[model samples]
Target: MRVLLVEDDQFHASYMEDVLAETLPEVTEIFHAMNGEEAEHEARALTIDAVVMDLRMSRRNGIDAARTLWMERPETRILFWSNYADEAYLRGIATIVPEDSAYGYLLKTAPRDRLKLALRAVLVEGQIMVDREIHRLQRRAASPRNTLDDSEFAVLLDLAIGLQDRIIAERRGMSLRTVQNRLLSLYEKLGVDDEASDAMPLNKRVRALNRALVTRTLNIETLETAQRDFDRWQSTRKRA
Candidate 1:
């Protein structure tokens, strides 16, 4: 297996190269690039089996680079490494690529073992492995009470994860003003009037989104039926 690694930080780039070498001895060659521009250049120049990319970079971010690579070479696999598990990031990438292709997303803080598992899954099984936090963020973004449109929800998830408006706007293909307007509308709907107010901190909004997601997941009708079943089961056990 040949891999292309795209990361700006020297320490992280070196550490990942070491990890990949140690973990996958079968990997014959590993190519390195400091940014997305270099990554695209190298990717087009060679035939690589997979790419390990960092989403946040100085120029031509991972998503754009990945899109270019995927379009140019559909057979090559992509695995994203990001510090944040923002919903906008996930959805943005999803919109660009089909689900069946070999892809994965890992948080920068992911455990080594988990990272290994994700790589193996993508390389061998062609399965996408999302970091646990990312999975949680996705579920939260699908919540009902958020009352946000798909785009707005995506941006809100990014905001909740501490992404700046500019990054969110770029990822979502919206202008900065549009991003701000959507955020304002979302906050209003959530009854949050003041940006400076503590009533709607990022973490708090994330928690609410999570709760709403859980509630939606357990569909009210299903919850009622489950409750009834539990009540009956308890009564029967008591009688026995």
Candidate 2:
């Protein structure tokens, strides 16, 4: 079986290469990509049957790359070996994978045997494999459809980084009223009942955004993605 190993860390990739080579003798060809951008290109160019990819990368994130890849090739098996099993990652992956296709989400901290098992399960048996913690998080939390949607998460990102509704509207190419509507949805989904919280003097938006941050959902990676988007938006505005 041919597999693509997508990771930004060279050492980690090399080590993983060794592990895969030793454990999975059926894996004949193993290609490597340092980031999601390269991974995307490789996926299109090569005869890859499966992929072991990282979630967070500098150029493009694994979720976006996986989405693109699956858009083109839905049957290709994916094994997400990530440093974080963040809810964002979970939500993102949930939207992309084919309704019937099997996949895996094993943590970076997992044992070597666990990684081997995930690799085999995803690539060979075509079964779902999530880390214990990720499974616990998934079970403890609401289903992806029940949680925040992408539009609401986009609004949350703006609020997480202190963006006003007017600015978020402009950045997202939506009307201010539409942005406000999304915020209302976000508040309800996040359960940021500022009205009930007597201690929080701030408005619902501030409280809701803060709740996301405190829960470690809206983290630096989220902010960085938003910042990169802002930079692109600013550049486009300047040009226009």
Candidate 3:
């Protein structure tokens, strides 16, 4: 079987190659790509049986790249190897994966045995293998009581990165009122307004962000990715 390993760090890529070589004897050829953009090109140029992709990359994120690949070849198998299990990344993966496709998500900190098992399950046996720690987040994501919808999630990311309501409204192509409504919904879901009788009430926006962070609903990696996206958007706006 031909496998494509997509990771930005060369050391990590080499490590993955070694692991695949040692674990999966059936893997005849292992291809490596530095990032998602290169992964896309390589997959299109060659016949890849399975892909091991990193979640975050400089050129393009793995979720976006996987979507493009699946658009062209829906049968392709994928195993996401990421350092983070952030909600945003999980949500992104859930959004793009085909209904019948076999896929998996494994954290980088997983034991070698678990990693090998996940790789085999998704890449060879065609099964779903999500990390145990991520299962709770997955359950919450599916739950309507506390989970943020796509619109709310987008607005939350914007707010987390210090975007003003007016700026978010303009960037998202929504009215100012719509932005405020989304913020209210976000705060509600995060329980930002639920204060104890003795505790001081913080600013709703700050409290919402704090709660999201405390709950692991929002994280540094998610914020970093959002900042990059925002920066790119701002650059495009400037150019326009």
Q: Least accurate stretch of 10 residues (summed lDDT) in model 2?
A: 193-202
Regarding TM-score, does 1 or 2 come out ahead?
A: 2
Judge candidate 1 against the unseen true structure and give its global Cα lDDT, from 0 to 1.
0.72
lDDT to native, each model: 0.72, 0.82, 0.87
**Error at 13, model 2, angstroms:** 0.8
Candidate 3 local lDDT, 1-240, one digit each (tens) = 999999998888888998899889989999999888999999999999999999888788888788889989999999999887777777777867898899999988888899889888999999988999677656765466888989998899899999999999999999999999999988888887676245675788888899888876776657876797799999999999
- Give all TM-scores, in the order shown: 0.63, 0.73, 0.72
| Candidate achieving higher TM-score, 2 or 3 | 2
lDDT of 1 by residue, 9-112 (tens): 99889888988887787689999998988999998898889999998787677877887898888777788988867654665577667546788899978888
Candidate 2 lDDT over 16-100, as tens digits, reads 9998998899999999998889999999999889999898888988877887788889899999988876776766677679978
TM-score, candidate 2, is: 0.73
Number of backbone collisions per candidate, in order?
A: 0, 0, 0
